[model samples]
Target: MLQSYNFALSVVLLNVIGPSLSNCSVNMALGMWQKLQIFLAFVQSCSNPFDIVCPHKSHVQFRTQVHCNSTRPQYMCLYDENKKQYTEVCVEEAETQREGYNTILRGGIDGVPCSTNNYQPFSHSSNTGGSCAIVKTSCNDEGQLLYDDGSSTTDRSCRCDYRVGYDYVTVPSNKCFCKPAIEDCSCYMKYCDVNQVLTQDYKCARVYKLTGIFDCPEVSGLGSKDIEKNKKMPSNATKTGIFFVQIDYYQNKDKTYHGILDLILGIAIGMIIASVVLLSTADILNVVRLKYSHNDVIHIVCNHVETVVLCSIELKCHLESTRHCKFIYWTKRINGDISTITSRTPGIHGSTVTYPSLTLDSPLIEDCGEYVCCAVYDYGRVCSPPIRLTVTGDVPSFSVDNELHNTDIGKPVSLFCKIYANPPCSNVVWKKYEDGQYTTIHSDSIDCSQTKYFTFTLNLDTFMESDSGYYFCYATNIVGTSKSKCITLSERKYAPTIEVDVDDNYCFNKINEDVSMPYTVSANPPCTSVVWKKKGDGTSTTIYSEKIASSPSKHITRSFKLVNLKEKQSGEYFCVATNEVGTTKSQSVLLYVAEAEDDDFSSDENRSTVTTLPHRRTRYHSCPSNWETDYYPIKRRSRLLS
Candidate 1:
């Protein structure tokens, strides 16, 4: 069996790899010792046929000449047909004795050597110098044999003492025999019991049979009495002269040996076909060398610049190609319009195309915008993502002065500083310095565009004394911060106040007579300068410096006089006063220079006698004549001209 298994293995290996090694001398290269080892392995695997047929008996010897080998010491007289003589052999080997008696039973019955109808009782004799007699055997109630002739024998025949692998059966002649038990008899019995024994009419009987053999027939209704017949036999003792009943067993058609082999072959063939297909597919794909074709990608980096920036755009193609490609750098405006960049364009080199840099010698705020790089190939044109270019600088210049500003109370004023920056100013703060301390007046974020300059203005709703201080404008951006020149702002303490006094609405003076208009000036600080002007014809005449007075009092009064009465001097007259804070003008008064009327009745000699018109005159005073006497009695004050 082992040799057959090895041969089958060799056949499978040859079927798999024989064609590849057909030209090789592998068999001739094997050593003699290896070949001898293989031959010895085959010889050792061969089985002895006698051991398989009669495993426990020594009668069938391979090398010995002994005729009978039995445990029984008794001798039996027998005839040997092969020897043609009456030979004395062991009781186990003798077939028959005289008087028609068989010492060795065949088929569990006593028989003569040559007689066809010889049936005699079986017996055994001891070799202890005693006469041999017929060994009496009796049957128990169950018809099992109980030997009373043996010295160590008991009458307990009802006990089934058979070996585990043997069973007792009753033959047709009412004789018992021990036989090897059938394996899986219950399964075979089930098959027959379902088909033949178990009828549709419900009549059934238990059956026993030996399956997978040719000679055994089915036996039915074998009871426990038959099983008890072989109970006394040893476990390893050989059973003979008994035939096992053959059962017509059922087999599953789907699980036959051929079906199992076909299933395995189908699986193996499918796996081989799958492996071949996979390898073929891999080879075909490797030969074809398929790949994806992609367009060129453009990259543009905007160089940061303080004064001048050199900007470049680069194009890279993922695939190698011999075709000519063109690259164009574009600039996008804030209004969403694209324009090609033609100046300073570079040439292409292999898979990369680098555009010549644009040099901004003095990049201004206008140089900042969105730029894009594009690659134009034979297939299509691809553009890079838009990038914003920013040309930033320090905070742009602004101008301011340290001049002082005086604003009146209850007036609105604005202090502003102009700032210019490239990226625009982010924050603006207005600070004030008062009493050696600085304070933030206002702070706010300013979004100044690149094209526009920002003006930070601090508004004062009502000017007050607290608003007087040194103010500055602080501007900041990404580059740096700057502060405007400080300017001092102060609230005007007093506005120039002027008052004009005249006796009448107009100045009435005869020819060659003079008329005077008095004006009062009041201010916190004394007036720095004063002017007197005529209202009519918008003429300003200079007043004599001696007429002006710097007064210690808060109010100062001055009078303007006409030396000669003239029609031009009769026009309206007013006084203007100015101080460090502001200027003010007094009310205008009309001065009339009149001509004297002549008498008709009298001659030049009688002109005196004629009615003389009252001397027309005008009086002007800064104070009442009564108050002048009460306040300045010690000094003679100027009185009204009457």
Candidate 2:
């Protein structure tokens, strides 16, 4: 009965724990497969298996779990084929557990132990095997699950599976995803309407596929009115179905931001263009103005003494004709008063106007003022600057110092004329009186402020007798003219000519007897000194020197006297005349002084008588019969002769 009870107990234990043990083994195998897949994924992501054992904080809760508890038997059942009986035996529990755990850990299964969680039954008849339980769940809105048979993970884990031309992105918590990629949307067309010109500011050539969000590029160069009218246009993409639409845009090439250098270049170009336009306009205006304007007036002068003077005004007009032109004359006084001159003769022809003579039969002092001439034409009038006129009562009054001037040869001399006039002398002229007429020598206008006197000079470098003449000056003004008295010029005296008168046979007694010799001297100016000189033995001695009386004809005769005739006075005698210019000597006359000659003094008929001649006559003396009467002629001599 006890044997029967033990066998029944063993059968019951097997029946109760068999299915549980199989399920546990299946769960463990599935867990190990899942862990292998996780290890492969981790190696692909981080390239290291150690990271899976120690994951980051974001993945710590999802790490794989490994089972470490052993599943082994402490006893075993043995079978005996010859006796056809089965027996039970004891085994090493610790050694058996250690060998079973090592085998499982090494991924090998040698034998099934009597533990429920370590073993499962195999059926060779069916292809289906035990697997882990699966539950059906839904994915998030943005993702879908990959179908495997008809089951999926019960933990609600899904992959991002999107349609064609679409993609997804997960949220920060990784529990949700988004499908932001869009296709076949025309957001660029909505922003830039059909009427809007496609420029660089509103270009849309590329398509956009955003991940997390949908944004469009900015559009520009649209007017405020256009924008307001197009307010109903869509600015953002629509989020529908499994995708969100996006549009991309580009900036306009023409309307772009400019740097400082570009801005400065633009401004400089604008200024240059404006300046060119202005200069062209100014040139045109100047050409037009020059075509109509008249030329300037030339300066003119007129004399004051004239009774009538033509007022001629010339106008140079560049136009074709000047048919309507007239001239007007005006006069102004020194006191700053102006008056229009109406009395004028009119003769206008083309650009020239010759007004009648301004007649003044009896012009007063008031008429001597400034005069001006003006031309009046159709376009404008041009006037010349005023000119002055002067009037006086009479010519200048002048006087000279002397009527004659005596100067030596090769000397300089000046003639002066002191003028006094009511309005001062305008001109002073020096003239030379020659050949019964006067010839101009020098002329100049005197300045009244400096002096009213005028002087003229004569330079005598090569003195000649012909230079001796009359010189006079004339002073002139507006009213009349006056002349100074004529002046004469005389040169210094020249050397004189001398002539001696003596008898050839006039003998004088060597005693207290008186004798005289007469000499005639002729010079330009009378002789100032006359001397009696004796020449003998190759020498000359002056016997007498005295001032001689002059004659009106510049010729004089003087007697050279000897108080007593002596033997020493028997030499040749001559007379000399001297003045400032030169000296002159007469021819020598031989004289004989002896004792009373026997034959000449005994004769009563040959008595020596001194006969005086007239003022310019030659003296005569008589000779005796026995005395010699050889005549010696009186010689005429000049200073210029040898």
Candidate 3:
């Protein structure tokens, strides 16, 4: 026979072929060793009963109680929620023998009855006392089972029991909301119930459920039972409320496998997109290179770029993405290809670019010409087409060196003129103004270097006051002409050579004596005039006058005579000479004249006269007179007189 109960509240086992069934007493006892082993395993797996159990009444009560005085024994109990209480069965209890009023319920889910057959006679109610009365009512709402009241008068009788079959006299009430009892009333609920096993729907009924995470168990068939002949069992066990709840094993396995596949697929898709983008960008760059040619930027315009700001034009290369490129060099092919690179940021295009714009520094006429620009990506030297830039006006440039000063009087002056030209000047001329005529001292054509720069010298040895104005060294070529700033020439001042001389008697004479002295003054550059002065008083009293000729080749000479000599007039004397260029003076000289000596006379001729004819004759004959003669004395006197 099959049996059924709630999985959480009661567990019914249909022993189809176990050898333990017997036909004697209502208690079916197990061997001591077997009983102890089952009890110990169950106790180890069960949670605390007090927290989980609830007590309630249900028809056909099945309960167990074990008390041992000789040994300390442990027992296992399970909660029966369908029966609304805890159910404990002793493993060592012996099974009952009579089959008078017993019916077994067999099925697998909650709320379904098991098959009832072969015990229909126990279903009749006789109101008589017999063993058949034990099957008086099926477990229903009226015949309720409860725990004993906690009092001395409380009923302790075991009204229901399970094993082979100790029948019950009353039906048990089944309720869902009863709380677990305290103290002796402690109970718990289980998963299965008796009605679920007896109903025919139990065989095919499906249990519906929903969960937080997806999982499903493998389906299996239910136990088969007949409801018509089944009678209620006396014992009531806990119902099997809702069991089989744990982690969602089935869904966890599927999610883990799905996640791994998604990651691999995502990586593959990313790699493919990156490769396509790189290839497309490379092809576009290649197409731009083939479109432009080198001969494009070599063009000529009539006038150079002039005006403060004219229309802005651009010189562009067709290459835009110059990520690997270096400088863009520009050259004027028509104008001898003078080259320069823009020191500014250029405009960028798709695969092309424009240079720093074709603008003027201050808009000059010299810039009106042709130009070219090239792009250098690396050491590889990539070149672009020449760009034709037409500046409107001519570029005027003044060539000059620093200002020159302190030149020698008779030396030549050479100033350098340097100019940078856009179209190459015609010629450079160095000139000076003389006699109101512009005389070109030096001239040269700039066609040699094409840059207007040359050296020129002006012979200024004969430079005079009239030549001391602004002298211009002008540069003029085919492109344009510019003059160096007017360099000023000034005449240098210099003193002339001066010579001075005094007459033979320059000393002062005695008072009232006629003393005469003469002096001369002279100079080169032909002294324009001359004058004399006395050193005692700086008064320039002119004693001589003369006019001189031109400098370096002419000179002048003048003389002055002083006719009066006096003690007071004896002092230093000097002369001054002047020329057209400057003046000069001589150093002073001092003069003094002494008085004449007085004569002394006596009565020497009154004494006597001695005659000597012989001495006289001898004196005529070129002989000396004798010593003994008075003629000798006379001769001596004559000698003294001669």
Q: Per-prediction count of colliding residue pairs?
A: 6, 6, 110
Per lDDT, what order, best first?
1, 2, 3
Which tens-of-lDDT digit does each residue in 192-280 have in candidate 3? 23211111111211111111111211111211112211333433222211222111001123555445544643453354334433434
Off by over 4 Å in 1: 1-391, 399-409, 422-426, 433-438, 443-453, 464-470, 486-497, 501-519, 522-525, 529-642
Per-residue lDDT over 1-642 for candidate 1, one digit per residue giving the tens place of the 0 to 100 score = 332333333333233222222222223222222343354344433522212211112322431234344463334333344554333344443333333244332323243332221222334332111112222222322223231222221111211112111223332221122211211111011122221222111123221111112222212222212332323322111111121111111122434543554455456445533543343454434334422234245444543323322222232213223445543434434444433343343332222344323433334456566655444443333455565666545565676643568787679878877776655666778888877877887544555645447677788888875677899887776656788888788865686798766554444555555455666788866777777765545556544323235655556766655544544445666777887688787777766555654432234442223233357332221112111211111112222211
Which candidate, 1 or 3, has the higher TM-score?
A: 3
All candidates' TM-scores? 0.25, 0.29, 0.28
Worst 10 residues of 1 by lDDT: 179-188
State the C-alpha lDDT per candidate: 0.42, 0.42, 0.35
Which number leads on TM-score? 2
Superior by TM-score: candidate 1 or candidate 2: 2
For model 2, the stretches where C-alpha displacement exceeds 4 angstroms are: 1-327, 330-372, 375-492, 504-512, 536-538, 548-553, 601-642
lDDT of 2 by residue, 474-558 (tens): 7776566788787787775679898765556343444435456665788877778877777867888766667756555577665
At residue 543, give the lDDT of candidate 1: 40
